[model samples]
Target: MSGCNKKKFPAAKDVVLLHQLDRGIFTPSISPFPLKLETYMRMAGISYENDFKNPMGPKGKTPWMTFNGNDYCDSQLCLELLASKFQKDFSSDLTAEERAIARSFQIMTEEHLYWVLVLWRWVYTKGKTLWDVQMNLPTGLRLVMPLAVRRIKAQASAQGLGRHSKDDVIEMGRKDLRAISDYLGTKPYFTGDKPTEMDCAMFGCLAQLVWSMQGSPYEEQMKGEFANLKEFCERMKEKFWPDWDQCLSPPRLNVS
Candidate 1:
């Protein structure tokens, strides 16, 4: 769990070495999948360290991990690995139907909502807002952002969401948000009063709107029309991320 160093590559016994982007002044990690994995680790009480160096894993994705002297990639697969190893089952108490619902919600957030957020951050905003808040980003990355934008645009187009207008994309995101809020209702967590694995994915995507994406229509809608969603984000933040501010670069002040 060393800070600002990758020389200590292999984590201590039973400690997870998470490879992901550097922290931001606004959020723990800019990418939701990384944030999702990190949140799952925290929720499961698994000891871990943050390795900003070599963020990309074998699968060429950020937020990969090294654990028990083994390397792992893909955030969802990483979650499964950690869950099996740690024996942490947040959804263990759920009914079969509830588990099915949780999986569906996770897919909706990660698959559908994630693309919309990406379009807004990387494509629509052109990574300006994202770059502005990132701490100590490399000069190379700044130079490569244009390529990254093109890649994302191409991916979005292939996914079919990019074919729609910006307004249509915003509406799609709103529908997803509304569905989540409706399901959440007054529950302290997504299902019942206790957090589950699905909550990690849910919070990962929702936290972006709460803190990272400034002036986004989705952000405004969540803050205004979807009071429950806002409350759920705040509740998850308070419960799991007590060091949320400290985790940020140049630690954000006056955070509510």
Candidate 2:
């Protein structure tokens, strides 16, 4: 891709201009992948800026970024590349076996659990839940919401998650949560005391349930049986997102 000649793209060297969906009322981003990448940047102390101008990048995915005028997409790939470039290894302390376990948890959260949430938010719930959190959506997006839901519905069906009943999807999510909870045990973070790349991805998904999936059983479970996970969300938010409230949509107005 050409250098950032477009006004929306950042021209600064060695600085990441993150292009992702607009922020939501309940979270900095209702989309987990972008939030994951942003959280990774925050944790690694990488210099970056958010650009809501172009939500879709070359690969047709949100959470893409421009570094040194080069565009990169895919949240996980971006995290790995940026980590190497910055010499930051959140999992550098992990043993070989521990690394394997962390990889498994990350895959479960991103692949399986992610589809579950997508089905719930788009297909099963018919985007009602998403509308609740993204209430301040732009007029253009409001017009496109129906088409977005249909596209997700087709994608979920193609992925086989939509073939299952709503109850089945919920059960799958519950089981995934149970596995994560059991593995997490009592550790302050996913891997151990300190957060890792896995935690960045995990928190990206779990925070959605904890904060944005209002009135859903998953939200209730996160706050109930999976209360530890809820606490984990709180911990991650406190550590990486001190400006959480300020990052919300409609902008939180401060009063003296």
Candidate 3:
């Protein structure tokens, strides 16, 4: 959309859901899967809540990705593998398969990071952050978009989610790189021999997760823990735009 316009800021998760390939039922907490569903419906051009007890999609694309007329982005493992890829070193740690996942994740991360910068630019030059654009979000999805980061903190405290937080999302993302580095048993890619939708999904999810964890505990801990994720994030940054998060425009929203 015109080199990443903020028009989709309100639809970030929707964008993620639509183009996403597949989904798993009842994967894990309200996270990426719901994002995939929203993205899938949006991509297929459905943007409203279904009032019917059972409402089916337009009978094709969405149906294919759904179970009982519901879309799910089956990417839980992909996301986990992504963290592994980040935490592990690629030079001496990755098998051929892991390398494939790393490469695929880097490509996708680059694409999203470029747009993140664009959104930052637009937040100042054109529109408000989606946070300000509208206070409402759509429903009938898998994950919860979280009213705010405070809610995230509260959720963490309530669940005692063990070393994970709204912040560890990024650390988990950084740790994903370890997949490649730690994989002493496989070849390139987590699934072996090829880059699949899993690889691509991991890319976007991990990148955003790390991006979200900007100043969390895991972030400080990860500064040098996995040089691979940092280097890979940088490499992806350079691959798209050499100067990222530079002094272009002030941030409008704290995405975490």
Candidate 4:
């Protein structure tokens, strides 16, 4: 019997990311997963094109990537695939224990923190108002915004985080932020001076919470209490986003 050989895939030169628009620093991404993937690419020095339309790729999700000729979905899976293909390990310098710790925090951020963000944006009134303003939907499409909110609420409910009272959910999110802040005390990055996959994961979550969810109770709490986390986000933004000021400028409108 002949053994099946692994197919050698070509190195990806042109990579395209479909994600939400840049609405100033307030909301770098409407969804965190795509932001995570984008941050990862930047950290790895991989050049990619940004395509905002039709965010749901082949897998019906944002953050999906088109590499070479194939489509890859899910942030974690896409990271693994890109790392393997490019021979770049985001955690290559970490010790075994550090890697394990990073993985744990990454999972916590994605699984737990992400849901809290969803609830904050779609379920709560204050957060929903902020989201609407940042989204800046057209007057015609504004009528459907409530329907969109309802759909998101249903999704949150199915995901189980929405089952809890709003207070409980906020508390859970606060605890998560506290844990991350404590772990990140006085460090330039999550794993020390250098940014790792953990930092990428964390930056994705914290950046949105701190900058995008401004005026919400959660953001207020973070700013008032978690100094380290706020500093961490700022540091990352300065280091990775050299065009930060450009990103904040409003898009030029076309006049007829």
In the range 95-174, model 4's lDDT, one tens digit per residue, is 99988887888889899889888787766862445433254433444457678778878888898998899999988988
**CA deviation > 4 Å runs, candidate 4:** 1-14, 17-25, 130-141, 249-256
Cα displacement (angstroms), candidate 3, residue 53, comes to 20
| TM-scores, one per candidate | 0.92, 0.92, 0.32, 0.85
Among all windows of ten consecutive residues in candidate 2, which has the lowest summed lDDT? 1-10
Which is the leading candidate under lDDT? 2
Cα-based RMSD of the predictions, in order?
4.5, 3.6, 14.4, 5.4
RMSD to the native, candidate 3?
14.4
> Worst 10-residue stretch by lDDT in candidate 4?
1-10
**Predictions ranked by TM-score, top down?**
2, 1, 4, 3
What is the lDDT of every predicted structure here?
0.85, 0.86, 0.34, 0.71
Q: Which should have the higher TM-score, number 1 or number 2? A: 2
| Stretches > 4 Å off in candidate 2 | 1-8, 136-138, 251-256
Candidate 1, position 3, lDDT: 28
lDDT of 2 by residue, 120-173 (tens): 888777786776776445557556778988999888889888889889889998
Off by over 4 Å in 1: 1-8, 251-256
Model 3 is weakest, by summed lDDT over 10 consecutive residues, at 1-10
